[model samples]
Target: MILWLTVVQIIVAVAAGAFCLVAGLVGRRPSDFSVGALALVELLLVVQVVVAIVAPLAGNPPTGDLLEFWVYLVSAVLLPIGAVLWALMERSRWSTVILGVAALAIGVMLWRMQVIWTIQVA
Candidate 1:
């Protein structure tokens, strides 16, 4: 795993979470700003996934279980898309809540990815 890239992903995810939370708290439905921010986050995650895959092929496999890491990566990539879909359908303040929760979940998932990347096996 590329350490700096992972750090960037974590920061972006957390920032997206904060943005969503504040929007939700203000009783705002999901807006272009929120969706755009999430899309950017998703884009970064896709880049991370590419790096994760290629780095291993280039002989830099993570220290942790590859399966676990892949699972986290895939889930992290899917989350924002799902949240955006749900928010578009719901079209209410609750939709913003969904986005907020999704953002936070992505943040946690990214952090977990970092843990998985660095974990040592006995």
Candidate 2:
């Protein structure tokens, strides 16, 4: 995984998580901004996928089991999609909570991706 992009994902995830926590307490519903966050996550995920596909072509190459990489990769790609679905279901503060979970989950997956890369490199 690209370190810079992963860093971005971590930061965004943390922000989204914090947003959710704060929103849940205020008794306010999630807004379009929540969906916006999910959208951003999806955009970043797309970038990562592009990186994954192009890295090998560029000769930088993935440093792990291709199948496992793909598994995590697909999950990473799906998180935002799930978030969108969750948000659709939850129009209230609960949606933010769901988004928070999605963000945290994506961040964890990103960390896992790094770990996988390190293991493969070793």
TM-score of each: 0.93, 0.87
**Which 10-residue window of candidate 1 scores lowest in summed lDDT?**
113-122
lDDT of 1 at 12: 82
Model 1 TM: 0.93
Tens digits of per-residue lDDT, candidate 2, 1-122, equal 67888899878877876776577567657777767777787788888888888877877666777778779979978877887787787677777777778877888887888677656763
* Candidate that scores best on lDDT: 1
Local error of candidate 2 at residue 121 (angstroms):
4.8
CA lDDT, every model vs. true structure: 0.85, 0.77
TM-score of 2: 0.87
Model 1 over residues 40-103: C-alpha lDDT tens digits?
A: 9999988988899799799877888888889988988999999999989888877887787887
lDDT of 1 at 61: 73
The reply for model 2, stretches above 4 Å from the true place, is: none
